[model samples]
Target: MASPACAATVSGAPFAAMDFPLQPRRPTPGQRALAEALARGEAMMGEGIEQLPAATYTDPDRFAAEMRLFRTLPQLVAPSALLPEAVSAVAHDGYGSPLLLTRGADGRAHVLANACRHRGTRLVDGDEVVGAKRIVCPYHAWAYKPDGELSGMPRAECFPGFDRSANGLRAYPSAEIGGLLFYAEDEQADFSDLRALEPDFDAFGMAGLHLYERRVHDVAANWKLIVDAFLESYHVQRLHAQTIAHFFADGITVADRVGPHQRAAVGRAALLERADLDDMASLRRAVTFTYALFPASIVVVSPDYINLLVCMPQSVGRTLVEDYMLIPEPPQTNEAAAHWQKSWALLDGGAFGTEDFGAAARCYRGLASGTIETVTLGTLENGIADFHRRIDAALAR
Candidate 1:
């Protein structure tokens, strides 16, 4: 259902609420458990404490294994809304592999190497979206359709074999669902597990949302540390005291995962007052949901919009984060633009950039410096615990 006003409360602090019409999403059984748990006022408890070696984050061998694991798994690219037209193309470089994301007349999204089949030249360059029907190689003018089907070359018979049908661009597996795009570096990557996310994405009306703004943060931290910062709320109260600390109930986040991906939610004190599940107003004010799309991406359902973050690792101590802010619709007035602009500023530069990521970078310094032998996670950080378990399994494979 459409969200009502959003509110945040802090002890000895003034209460606050924000009114914005967010796209509606159905409440699932997971969310039901979240509400009930809040009503019970229970502290977060898990299987107890877990300790992981600091080398897990700083070892060169481990970093190579992690990179291998990430490539084999599917990664969230961007909202399909960014390339809604049947014939469209966008160049993306944040996924470690330079890619040309295209939607053909068949309405299926395709993720292909940005390099042209000839001389491995980049067929498309830059970040702007292209609506051309054929991708022409900048070097030789060899043209191919959006589906990567080779159409013609400067000389039809000059090349060996001269077979256009088998000379298309190299491609990886890709899919489009609920307005989002996903691809894997492995062509045989199985995507059945991703079906679990469609219902949630549909509820958010993600397919129809507008792309408000996008920013990239290349920070000094291991990529997993960035994800770790978001997998729990233990730091929300203290780390975000001046920003969003008053907005949520401390230490009460509920989490569950599908395959390696996790869906989690944290509620506010007002959550106890929300008696009806269908009451969108109280529900919006009381709970906020976060989706940890494994390997690389995170989608946060905020009070009025959604934030999608894709974290790509460059080395044992560096990461690049691409953040996209999605809204219900395009801003039609200056006031509306200002509304999203203000939200973007606070989140991009303030909450995520300075607080969460900043902390991750500092932790990386300590871990890499060999000051800590192991990273200790308490029961409250069950989500982070689960995160490491998934990684361990992948690397072991």
Candidate 2:
């Protein structure tokens, strides 16, 4: 039998029964004190903000502050460029969120919340062929049109005064830029427009790309920690010595903060080099640019593909990282798919899921130990400092 429709209206409160990973564990007095101290310490680039002391990493209080920052800030989800046709929409539940991407009959993309407006059941399951037309919920037979309006219900007359016009799938705000889609929970966010970063996207050549393969991982670390790993290449030599070290500069990295909203850092060489494809007609010419759309999303551009990282905080210490690899649209072939899969596995296995996270995991353990007093920010990694400051300021509001 189909599950019953939920009672809450989409706009008023689909979140009534939703259990988001928003709450942090209770903190002790010492932890609270330490968090306050760290927040109060001014984080200027060349001043006392040199390196986070070992004590900061080990303190329970500092961890609390990190959680506070994540919960308060408005996170960046997608770029405006990717929304030309909304392909799919993702939703947040108590555990993790769901993403729904679709290509409509009109050859347009539309993304909407993955949760059914009724009873909160997931509307779309897996990556199956949804095709064109309305989305029918497998649970209670409720259906919604592509534009997120109510279409049908199993038994319309069972309940009197049923008003389909008053209820539709709740949609979070979405935008795109540089061929990337962006979603945000805050409807009032002004930074949703990517035209502000036109020069950056043009320089990266992200306009002509096509969405290809995407990989999602439930990473066991704070979202900020995952983000910090990508802002600088300082540890590339030490941590990723064998896997990705050959393609990156171990010591020299450039970090720049454009404003409160974005930070970017470039390595000497692109990580995913495909020099053998000189004759291949569709190869994107640029490689090796790493940029972060402050608060969450990170993008890596290579000659063959562009890797976009979208992260969401799952708990005080856990995060979900979505890694998307976009390549030039090519005929669907087994060999091409296999090659792309191998490329994605290689990057996720070595750079992020392993070495990068290995370092951050240690940092987490140290933070809980109360041994590290504060985190030190490198001058070259000024972006890191700016990120910390922005978090502090946003949470303060």
Candidate 3:
């Protein structure tokens, strides 16, 4: 499972191998209540429904509290399609936390702190330094290997007890599933048991997948705001009327595990049972399966490829989203690449791109003002509400 270098480093190593605590097979009391509320369409439904307190999404103190929660809480951030070749990690410094990603020649993933251990410099700037074994710090000449090992430091003699063996870069606890890698940065948090959220590569159909395209979004909103927008299809009939409304339905169903991870299903029977899809064989491609992996990642899978949306907080009011379009396997020819590109462009240029971002930005600005005190989430938006509730609970702990 490991290359020669990785094997040698890990073999009989003193470092405690990451052991995730096994979550119970059954859902907790909170899960049962939330599930029941979603089933009955009560928690987030009806006129004059008390909105989720706006302070949760707007106030600076609230934002800071949430940030600390995400950074320290024992929540699982779901894996992505590139889990084999890329282990995405998120960490915080004085300014803000950045998502760091890395992969080895052997296809193992490792998410580490983006900053250099020595001088606090970002080791990864963008997606350019991917698939490389050597990562040389841009600020200083401090160099390190892919597995978080320091092969050389300029002045080794000056720093006493500076054991290169003990100075490997910090590695957040991460595990891969169905082509995605899930991780948490809490050092004392136990994550050895992951049965609560079993590996669902087959259920998600992520095996043998390949990268298609990456969409980098500098969204001007809180990460949760964007995630909340993506969690529901209630807006499909109205907000997305110009684009994806025709393909999606007005209703939704949701299911959750012990962790923050949850799955939302949208009815595609309209397309399957309707005669309008008679000519489109691909429409039988199965219903829309949207998985919100734990903390801050959403994996949207269709018949053709998987679209992954990852939200990383930039500031109290801003977020950096890295969106990727992935296919089952690499394209074999120019025609295939062209076909993928066309689909990507249509999705991005059309509703999923502009409409989603545009509406989310407006919502954030409105929240920023004191006018709105609460945001009401509907039954179809249960997934979104559940996410917020889960976040609040985790942070409250």
Best candidate according to TM-score: 1
lDDT of 3 by residue, 65-123 (tens): 77775666433333354444442322323224454656655667666677788888887
Please tell me which model should have the higher TM-score, number 2 or number 3: 3
Give lDDT per model, in order: 0.76, 0.52, 0.56
Better of 1 and 3 by TM-score: 1
Which 10-residue window in model 3 sums to the lowest lDDT? 1-10
**Taking the tens digit of each residue's C-alpha lDDT, what string does model 1 give over 1-397?**
0011111332222233345576445666666676566556654556678888999889988888888877888888888777868889999998678899998988888999898887899988888889859889988899988998888799777886767788899888888876788889887887877877787677667888888888789999989889887787778778888777766656766666767887776665554564466543345455666778877688887756778888988888999898888887888778778877877877787788888889999999999999989998877776777788888888888
Model 3 residue 169 lDDT score: 76
- TM-score for each prediction? 0.91, 0.70, 0.74
lDDT of 2 by residue, 318-345 (tens): 6677766665554267766776666566
Model 2 TM-score on a 0 to 1 scale = 0.70
Off by over 4 Å in 1: 1-25, 279-282
Off by over 4 Å in 2: 1-111, 127-129, 202-208, 263-287, 331-342
lDDT score for candidate 2 against the true structure: 0.52
